[model samples]
Target: MQELAERAGISGRTLRHYHQIGLLEPDRVGSNGYRYYGADAVSRLQRILLLRETGMPLADIAGVLDATTTPAAETEALTGHLEHLAQERAALDRRIKAVEHTLSMRRQGREPRMDVMLEGFNDRYEEEVVERWGRDAFDASNQWWHGKSVQQQKEWKARADALLARWREILQDGHEMDSAKAQEHAAVHVEWFKEIPGTPTHAGDTAKSVDMIRGLADQYETNPDFHVAFGTQEAARFAASALRLRVRRLEPSSADDLRG
Candidate 1:
């Protein structure tokens, strides 16, 4: 076990923890109580580490490993992980270039352009938006966002943070999802949604906005990241329910037609 741990560049304790959690187990255990791992164990350990680098929870990692019953499946999963890592690397490179531009401009005694100042700070949700809504929608939204000044962008982000914080506090206070305050909060959420540049709400299309709100409600309930952001899966579900109810109440004429 010690040799295997050393070979894997992980401590013996971590190896033992993996064993205890049924993540990885030794191929054999001697009568004297020492554990032994084989070459397969080393390969599995490397895959586990790679998945962990993608921020997958241990339970999800186990599921992914279990689901890869064949070499083909394993290769497919690893390919997906490689794509994710590549995107992360690209984002970091953009951020580094943005910072370098800022520093160079300062050294030259000139103000940095808004584009240079805002690079890499925005678009964390670019991939998610593109996947959910279509490339055209994402492109329009991204273009609108990049056109804003740094201060405007910061103020917009601050408003978003404040809204999330308010929801967190409201959930922590044990308020019911359909309570009056919760509905009011949902109204504010929709109002905030209207301020975005590329959405249907911004275009004064009430029908499309209703559809978007319903889609958002479903996303809040189902998206794992939303659960993480909102403090819990249950909290996300609550927010979804509140938003759905508020949308139904505010746009009763279109409520029946709103698609999830």
Candidate 2:
């Protein structure tokens, strides 16, 4: 157990907790009551760590692991995780470069341009966008955003702010989740995503579009920035629930051909 824990860069106590939660278990127990893990355990731990890095909950990771019964399936999942990590690394590199440029500007007693600031901010999630969709997805969106005139950008922000205000009002009105008015707002919410240049929804990739919408809903529920922007945690949660229901109504498929 100690060896596996060290190999996994986690403490023995964490491994024990994982066992307690049934997220992971040793291959066998020795006669002396010691925990033992084998090569299979190492592989499983690798998968667990990779999925954990992707921000998947332990329960969700367990489900994914359980569903990966064949070697082929496991390989496919691992490949996908690796690609995501690579995208994240690339995005982080861009963010680092942006920060460096900002520092240089400050040293020169010059403020960075608005475009530079937005570039850094947008690049902050470039890798995440790439991982969620692909490089072309990020590139297309980035180009579209950067190509906009200052007036257009202001208009876009105003529109977004207005939409958020409507969401806040809806939550404050205490409308039930299943209300027609709420569903109408939810439909507008989904439509908003379709305007993005690189999203699967924009490309009409139904499966990936639904998946992306569902993921964004999860983020809106749990992300602190989203909570602050949306008025309250409860409001964000309500919005997430509504978005999830809307996405579920989309055609279901495992296909993710929105690589571009």
TM-score of 2: 0.52
Per-model clash counts, in order, read 0, 0
Candidate 1 per-residue lDDT over residues 1-260, each given as its tens digit: 99988877889999999999999988988999899988888788888998888776688678778886676765676677678778677658767877998899899997664431112224655676566555666666666775678799788777776775677778888888788788788878877776665666555566767777788778778977666666678877888898888777768654332221
Quote the lDDT for 12 in model 2. 93
Indicate the worst ten consecutive residues by lDDT in candidate 1. 113-122
Q: Which stretches of candidate 2 lie over 4 Å from their true place?
A: 1-121, 252-260
Candidate 2 per-residue lDDT over residues 131-236, each given as its tens digit? 7778988888776775688799888877766665677788789887667777788878767766778877778788777777787788778877677667678877
Best by TM-score: 2
